[model samples]
Target: MNNTPESSFERCPVCQGSGSLRHLVTIREVPYWRCERCQCTLMDARCRLSPDDEQEVYRLHDNQPEDPGYRRFLNKLAGPLLARLAPGSEGLDFGCGPGPALAMMLREAGMQVRLFDPLFYPNHGALAGQYEFVTCTEVVEHLHHPLETFSLLDRLLKPGGLLGVMTCFQTDDSRFANWHYRRDPTHVVFYREATLQWLADHFGWVLEIPAKDVAIFRKPLSQPPVPGNG
Candidate 1:
């Protein structure tokens, strides 16, 4: 495989930083690039699947709400988030897949939850209001425009609210070629811990890694006026 830079791939989709991305590797003929500025890896845009094809791939996932193993998987994000959320706090489950097991779990925990997914739910109105907490589990990797999507997440969150994200962190570059996470064609972007930290700094949110592959960011609360400054 030729490792030369592709002309069309100029900027980092996550940070919008130009000249900072280098051709990382080609796996199964799909080109992936690494951005020095944000420390995130992304698949070449040209290689992404079309909407119909992507939806078809998603349909194959059997993430049922009644599945005990699936609930345990979602609990990784839910446990920490529920610990911080107040009683009856409103939340949004961004990119809730077809089954929406996470949303079900949150609702059962005494919270008002709304669902949003471009392919599954497609509720445009759901994105209009801010919430006390927003959860994006196993979803960021599929983002085509991550920068904009993250900005939207920031907008969706209320002051001092929490944004819980769960994704398999890309730690070892040597194994990236054969990594199962990268093998999924719909997964266009890969994030490292540094990449998540960059997002926290960019959005002015405080980040916490409560568990492996789970990051919770708290939107900073408005500071009170200093004494004698008013």
Candidate 2:
């Protein structure tokens, strides 16, 4: 794809912003654009892998639940979230992937963890339940429609629930071209601190950045009144 603003054909998937994407950079001949409104970055759809190919790539991942290193990696999100939960709280591990390591960790802490992954678990029943917390570690970047995913998460949580997200954040436009995280073909959408803040503001959730790659959004105890609701 051409490295130009005119080449950004897709609307900003997060905020639905239009005509605001500028070609930010290209890497390995794949073009990416940045949304002016939300600061979310997107790869050209042409670069996305086919489902079979994507699954093949995922099959190569070394995310072994038994691996101590992997467990520690998951603790980055789980540690903070666990501290906030009441004893024996129920939670869902969204996009638990093949190993469901985070789910294992949470269960080990006495919290009940339901696992769901579009590719792996596919437990549609899990989607019907409310939870005290929901985690989506390293999963948001691959969402083709993050808006819908976020909406589902919001609806799935009980009042004052926590939504924990773990993904490497896009730090700067200049560094994007060579960023190792961007090299993954399955990773389509990218988030920045500002992009997550936009989500928090729009969804009436409180945002927290507990770590460099972690975002924790707390659902309000009561739904906020819509504009002009009085």
Candidate 3:
């Protein structure tokens, strides 16, 4: 019996590259694929949970502002980001979960933060303006349309602004089947360090890995002029 996954011929959701996806693994009967172009692993679309079910999973989380443990966990991303921002930097907490603890933490550091979560604090207006920084902790894995979502993230930043992302970076394929991060039904996409670099190159942003599972991208103050006969 051939165990190989039949050719998907589907474009990679992360980088929109075609003919580069190959079956990576199946856990608990759910299929996942890895993109050769971007090194992003994505769950089969057929296995995705309904919106209501996905939201319910998020609701079960207890990441509150007062949870010292959670605060420490978030500090991995926050500490590095705070060091780079100037005083009173305006920012947005994209995909801040039910508790919005990260936003509260940043606010405590004297930064102004607006919140936006499709499930919890969905305020469309919050995305209308750009910001000096944007934090997206544990959010990229849930993106169903990464290309469009990332494009939106890019637009949400001001020139020379920072965009911070935190997700369990997919490593050690030998343990992928048992990886705790991939077991969550809502976490449909996984990124490798190479994958993050692809995003930085594609968006013309400078990339920084200040800590494990954390990536910070800085948008250029101004885009360089396209090559032309001058």
Candidate 4:
């Protein structure tokens, strides 16, 4: 039961499903919608930034690989993931940002990590290779096409592979208007805890909330049927 009227019906970008989306907030005159089904909050397509503008915003981030604070920030996702993996497993740091500090951290733990960032380190070969796990740290919010991006991750992982993601969960609509995370012009999507669970259920992956802002999903050994294959 969507509280908003049928006029708000726009297919959810994440799930590509029919859902009622209410106008959640308006920041700097940019409207964002919240889907009742998946609980995904997405910026209006008209409010999206141009490629050049997006790149410029990413370029301003100071997350150098050697920066101590940045390294600590990455450890939030890396530490738990390292503990779960088997010895010497290979992984991909998806959307590793310009610095790729998470890749560095994984390498330090004796795992082979390949880096891929659309802007900073574009390596098609890395995406083609299968990995035991994938890390997407602080990356999902900036995704313009999350369903495709996540499907790509699904294809890149081997059986029983892990997908670890870190992002500030969107909670409380009243607080959203002034939320710091939503202020970033490049962050176009927001996820609630339910949204993450919905993704796991949709994809047949096992979901776990390991820590604040961190969600881990493990792929089943056997692939599930495609949505319409039955």
Candidate 5:
């Protein structure tokens, strides 16, 4: 039932909107982009990952936080985030991918972790519960409608919840041209700190940039003012 039309967003033709561009290197062509707002290099848009294609890739990954290497990598976000969570926190791993590694780590930390991934864990019912935290590790870059996804993540949060995200930010134009991260066709939309700031401003949430590749946004305990209301 992968009904997403291939041309829904027109493939961001100029940079191909692959969100990366290709550079002619001495040995091989390199892919990257030059962000208009941030002036950072990135990848040029390529043929997108069809829903079927994305699912295929997920089927191949095997990771769990119990794996020492996995834990070591995840703790980069988990340590700081764990410190912020209250005991018995209930949370969701929005894009758990194949192994649900982060959920495993969160559960290990005593939080009740619910997992969701459109392709693998399709228990849509989990979305019904409110969470004190939501983590989308390396997931936002693949989002087609980041605003829509963020809104849903926001709605799924109880007041004062933390939304933790991890994805490399565009830093220097020099590196983007050959950055290995862009090789994955699934990654699309790139984010700048300002992008997160814009989201925080509009939603009335507080934003924090703890790691170079991670962001944590906190939803205020009170509801944000209704749109267009003074």
Candidate 6:
């Protein structure tokens, strides 16, 4: 008896209930699933962890403060972002986690970096206004509401400001159940390249896939496009 109420998890929380499954993909023999509704790949709802359960899991993470490899990985976006930004660019590290390595990196680059994480930093005020740049590396998948969150981010940046994101895109017709990402219950929403485009169009921003798992959207000061992009 699969009495588990799917609605209890909220209707396709990723796409605000309107989003539907687009396709599925496999990563390392593990199956992954995506919603066409939001073009988001996700672990099924049954895999979800309660709030307390997730917090306990996070406590177990040992993200080293000085990991060169991690820095190098983050550089996929940071490198290009630094190039686009001037010194003193105001930046926000949404979902900075307990160890905010991303925020530190931007601060090191002479940017004014603020952090907001529901648990660790927990400063909703950081989203109150515009920013020169905003980074959500390895964060979007954790969102229970991609539509709302992304829209908020779009509004948070000044026209011509930058929004950076990093999350593996879900592919089509492949392995899913064994995907390592799905093993983590905290990751709820999945994304696709087309999904980003949907966002670009919806928000009137420029979207770029600078590297695999790395996405950037820039808002233009000019009039919005009839066929918007992101």
Candidate topping TM-score: 3
lDDT of 1 by residue, 1-230 (tens): 95585834667888888788888887777778999998999998989999999989999998999999999998999999999999999999999999999999999999999999998999999999999999999999999889889989998989999999999999999999889999898999999999999888777888999999999999988733212200
Instruction: Please state the error at residue 15 of candidate 6 in Å.
Output: 3.7
Single out the weakest 10-residue window by summed lDDT for candidate 2: 221-230
Per residue, candidate 4 scores C-alpha lDDT tens digits across 1-230 of: 75432333357778776745777766776778887878999988887889999899999998889989888877888888988999899999998887888888899889999999988899988988999999999999998888888889889889899999999999889999889998898998899999999888878899988888999899999978646311
Candidate 2 wrongly placed segments (more than 4 Å): 1-5, 8-10, 225-230
Q: Count the backbone clashes (under 3 Å) in each candidate.
A: 0, 0, 0, 0, 15, 19
Please identify model 1 stretches exceeding 4 Å from their true place: 1-3, 223-230
70-137 in candidate 2: lDDT tens per residue? 98888999899998899999999999899999999899899999999988899999999999999999
List runs of model 4 lying over 4 Å from the truth: 1-9, 228-230
Give the runs in model 6 whose Cα sits over 4 Å from its true position.
1-11, 17-33, 223-230
TM per candidate comes to: 0.94, 0.93, 0.95, 0.93, 0.79, 0.83
Clashing pairs in 3: none
Report how far off residue 142 is in candidate 1 (Å). 0.4
Q: Residue by residue across 1-230, what tens digits does model 3's lDDT show?
A: 98766644368888888788989887777778989999999888988999999989999988788999999999999999999999999999999988999999999999999999988898999999999999999999999999789889999999999999999999889999888998888999999999999888888889999999999999999955322211
TM-score for candidate 6: 0.83
| After superposition, candidate 5 runs with Cα above 4 Å error | 1-46, 226-230
Model 5 lDDT vs. the true structure? 0.70
Local distance difference test values of all predictions, in order:
0.90, 0.88, 0.91, 0.86, 0.70, 0.75
